[model samples]
Target: MAGRWTLARGVIHERASALDWAMDSRPRSDSRARECAGLGDGLSPAELSNLTPRAQIAEEWERVRLPESDRKLRVLIVGGAGVAGRNTAASLSKFCPQLQLVIGARNKDKGVQTVSTLGGNSEFVHVDINDFTSLQAAMADSDLVVHAAGPYEYADTKVLEAAIESKTTYVDISDHEGYSRRAKSYMNKAIAAGVPAITNAGANPGVSNLMAATLIHDAQTENRGQPQKLRYNYFTSGSGGTGPGVLSTTFYLLADEAVTYHQGEEKKLKPYSDKRSVSFGEGIGERDVFLLNVPEVASARRVFGVPTIDARFGTAPFFWNWTLLAVMKLLPVEILKDRRIVQFLSKFAYPFIRAVDVISGEKAAIRVDLECSDGYNTSAIFSHQRLAEAAGTATAAFVLAVLEGSTKPGVWYPEEPEGIAVEAREKLLRRAAEGAMEFQITKSFCRRKEKQGMKLGWIN
Candidate 1:
């Protein structure tokens, strides 16, 4: 596939350069080899030594030409300084070469540095998420906007408003559980405004949605009519260059102790209500997990009709979880929000939290275990802290592909179609490989004991 792409590129290059060769009109078989070599023979000693194999190849063949697929993409990535933004930019540059990638940041210098380091044809713009005028100005003449800069706990929907106003597609990696739930309120307006918006494109929210969709699809096909049972034992044990780090989420978990959920009916859960033993691949052995109330699972419940679903997450090392539990029990209710307390945690607890698994050197490793009806049980583990960036990059690739007519414009997610998901994953993996940050996904399933069937239906 890569060789074919290279051959096609060569042909395009040749066609584009044909006009120059025609003007010269000095093409004879004798000059053919020399011209194809591209390196002028009269090079000085310094130039001759610097010549590379790739350069020599460029000199030989006339590149093939095809009608350019107008990926008329002017993608504006908000919060381009962070890890996700940087990864997204890198991926877009590689997979969507014809895209006009723009990275926007409140800090001009940071934006410039991000674009310069990430490479590809990229530009930098100074914009603030909080400031509407700034967002509007930066987003002008853009077809898509990916909002990656947020603790969205503090962000407003002004960015979404701007996107709707500009008639541009919008996607965000929002960690704030509140924002994601409320985002549905604007779906009608967004649809009416003729713009598609995604509230969470990062892990948990992004990948979780796909995982649920895939499971639901499988369940529907396998099961006939019974209650489907599903549970997720998810864990990520590494810090990456982007998105909310382990330490930050730890603070969030500590602060939000009272977790609410739906049973047969809606109810509240004491944080850690359902603790269970879980396991990942080698080096990442068995670990205890706890159910935390997150909007991703909630959205999955509402969006996909997987009647019984539970999501449990925890970092490994039995001692660590025990200590965290102890801290949560002892910490005073009021002190959870204390500035000094958070600062102290940032200074002291975060470093230790991030270093829990230095042996593996993984940015993160996530495992999702599913036990469906009819005794089909499976578990898949993915390791890569760079996945947050891959999510952003994959999103960018999709946006570019949509603009290029490789895909259609509509509200969509990774699991909407297997082909689309595979393409996006390929693009992301290619870019990740270039950066030495590969996103590895492995799946294993077992049909242990055959049992009763289950019924499945789309909730929304």
Candidate 2:
């Protein structure tokens, strides 16, 4: 149950020609060939043509040789005063001690407090993520910037813009679909500056995306059938101790329209609709999950070429779930979309939410299920006792990869081959899974028994 299983049934296409281009430095003349060749295998011509010049360059840069840097890596965590940011700083300090850590916050006192708590080659810097001048000044001294400022629903790409301008590598735990799309739009500028950037690099979007990628990558390497459908199910108990920003984020998501792909077409559905039950296997069992606007839906559909992709999330202290559904049902869209109103409502509900958190305890889990044409089903599950720790650990893993040169120059999603190479995928997964209570990949088969009135049978 702790290890991985493989089943071979379908033809594994040759590893995309992109593997070859990774080493070749000379530029190809034929724009068409370059475009086609730049697209890793399995992508259609239309997908290739949609690539901007910078995105294409970023794809090519994946394999290009990068010069070694003797200077120690410097990482600046933008919202280091907050839970996720502080945890990220701590993880990096403990795991990758060679890298210098800087905690960026608007409040010097909180930054100092965090640095004191983390203690070790860590320092504090004053930075207001919304202020370009402050952000640029902070980025000037850092080699990489980790954006942990929350409630990304209303966040602008100013920090990312500053990163591109400063030519510093960037990573963010943004969960907002619109913000992720906007960050991706900066690919051209990032590539032109020779700076690599990764968006949606946190727990759900980050680890969830990687889970799907791991399954797809393994199937591709082992000759498993093509994945036809991908489903994401997540459960977090009582806000997982992440605080008001997380609550605000949840409220914002409840108001936004959910996006999913069905039969190879994009479909929009009301948030909190399409409820389903998913078994998390062992310690965490079945929970009622509902549709949410998680960024992984879009990333998986585009990168994995899966026709059906969807994501659902549920929280414990079941009444919290009920309350969310009730709010979504009773409130108008205009009021829900208002950030000020949502923040005010979130503040009002904080005490009640915290009371539930006290009893429910902080635990989080993500389950990703992939199905293929040959009746094979594969799953990857990651669970941790605390959401903050899990998210921070995963984000730190990406930071390590970026600092170690695993990532290339350009903006990329966590599941993108260019963002995380197939060769480095296993290593990244291992690093991210550290401290996880359960990390597993399971394989099984289900076949339709036509003779017995359409009965179903399972084969192990």
Which predicted model would earn the best lDDT? 2
Global lDDT scores for all candidate models: 0.54, 0.78
| Number of the top-ranking candidate, with TM-score as the measure | 2
Q: Tens-digit lDDT track for model 1 on 1-460? A: 0110111111111122221221111223545534433532564555444322222121132221223645555789898876678777766665556667788987888788888876666899888888999999988878878887765654688888888788787877775567776665676677778776666666655555554554455445656233255566565554443334335555555666433434434455656557887754443556678877566656655655556666677764556667667867787645655645655765576566556556424344455545555445433344444445545544554454344333233343444452134334433223222222222222222334423342121000
By summed lDDT, which 10 consecutive residues of candidate 2 come out lowest? 1-10
Question: What is the lDDT for 236 in model 2?
Answer: 93
TM-score of each: 0.70, 0.83
Model 2 error, position 137 (Å): 0.7
Can you write out model 2's per-residue Cα lDDT over 141-165, one digit (the tens) per residue?
8999999998898899999999999
* Residue pairs whose backbone atoms clash in candidate 2: 22-63
Angstrom error at residue 108, model 2:
1.6
